[model samples]
Target: MAYYLGIDGGGTKTYALLTDEYGNVLGKGKSGNGNHQINVDIAANSIREATLSALSEAGLQLEDIRHAYLGLAGADREVDYMILHPIIRNIGFTNYTINCDTMIGLRAGTNHPYGISIICGTGTNSAGRNTQGEDYQCGGFSYMYGDFGGGGSLNIEVFRSVIRAWDGREQPTLLTDLLLQLLGYDAVEVMFNDFQDYGKQVPVDAVRLLFEAAAKEDVVAIEILNHQGVELGKSAVAVVNRLGMANDAFDVVLVGSLLTRGDRGWIRGPIEQALLTVAPHASVVTLTTEPVVGALWSAMEEDGLTISEEVHVRMRSFSDFELIK
Candidate 1:
């Protein structure tokens, strides 16, 4: 009768799932902006709301859960754990495991101890775990930390390209019109004025237009996607080299919006080419499981459950709930 909880807390939203000991997804809850670096109170409240909603849907109380796992963004350092642990502890789960979101994204796709994981959402990062349980990471510290190729970064690049095109510094691009259309501006001049007057950050989701433009063979947009893919590949290769896993036949899970969204070939194709150049034996795969599912799987593992391939397949197939979309 035991149950488990899994949470994926991110910069834009939070997702929580409730599952039975047998891996059946019983309930799911979602909330907003749970990255602790932004605002701990907002993050904590989001986590609490998602947890309670999932618990209520599962017809279970907090005390009924045996264990929980939280995969969180902006939780890289020990200080981050120190700040986040208490937030969850206060949410009524005493037995919990917390780790960076990239780890769970990796675990969601494979059980291999040695593999690379590249996440490209609001931010980008890469991590690889060796057979000895040693971990190596690259590019999760933000742009200031020398990371690029996430949705946020790509969006920034798109705006810059549009600006350059408008000013005739760069070749004319469809992105100029596309960006204005999406932003509800009729002309580039207005966007230019606003961008200069007030530093308004573009929505990360607006990167979808880049995908749309690329689908139509927009040179600038496709170039941006390709560049991002190469950067992501470089990040993965760095982790693989750091862990000496280039020769290992390991999984490289691609997670996050830029990789998972529509017609991802513009991104995926280049990334695969770049990784294979360095790690010929590496098998690149898209992450199909939501991060919360990875957290739940880890919870079951921590609880001493022997998860078979059949169970893993079943868990992957259980896509009944929304994933904070």
Candidate 2:
């Protein structure tokens, strides 16, 4: 009769899942902007709103929950813990564990409790959990922290390639034309002027041009993707080496849009090749289940419940449940 609650809070949205001990999803809820680093009050409110909506949909109260697991963005440092602990306490959950959102993404991509998760979305981040239950993370801070190879970073590379081609520093590339078309510029000089003199930023969506150009066999675009893929793979390798998981048979979960969407083969191929150079037994998996379901699985495991095949099946099947919103 016991119920569990799981929450995934990110910069874009907050998602909550309510489920029974048997892993039947009872309710779902969602809200906006749950990264506490952006605004603590707003993040807390988003978490509460989502949790309350899930509870209401399930006709349950907070006190009825056995355990809750929250995977939240910006929960990385101890200082972050200092900020988030009281927020969770004040929300009235008596039994809960909070972890970085990357952990949920890792869990979502694989059923194993320990593995590496690489996120290549707007930004790049890498994290891993070893069989010893130890966790290590790298490259989520910003570009200054050596965290590169995502949409934001790819956008920069695309602009640089176009500029290089324009100045004859690099061979002319299809990306130049694509960039000109995307930004509505007739000349690379005008685009350069707008970017430098007018402080115009490159649109993140422009990163797709890399895939588009690569698909057309543009050497520069393919090289860019290959280089970025190697960088992303190196991040994963760093985690694998740190965790001593090089020989471990485990999953290397790929999370985020860059690795999951578009013509991913250009990047994914290089990444897999790079990973195999070290962790030969590692398998790369794209996350198919909602990350909040991973939070539920974590909650169940924390409560000493065995996650059976039936549980996995039920959770995956119900992952697309309507959000309370």
Q: Residue-wise lDDT of candidate 1 within 147-210, one digit each (tens)?
A: 7767777888888899899888888888888889889998888998997899888888778878
Error of 1 at 313 (Å): 1.6
lDDT of each: 0.83, 0.89
lDDT of 1: 0.83
How would you encode candidate 2's per-residue C-alpha lDDT over 252-272 as one tens digit per residue? 888888888875578788779
Error of 2 at 248 (Å): 1.5
**Which candidate should be chosen as best, given lDDT against the real structure?**
2
Candidate 2 is scored at a TM of: 0.96
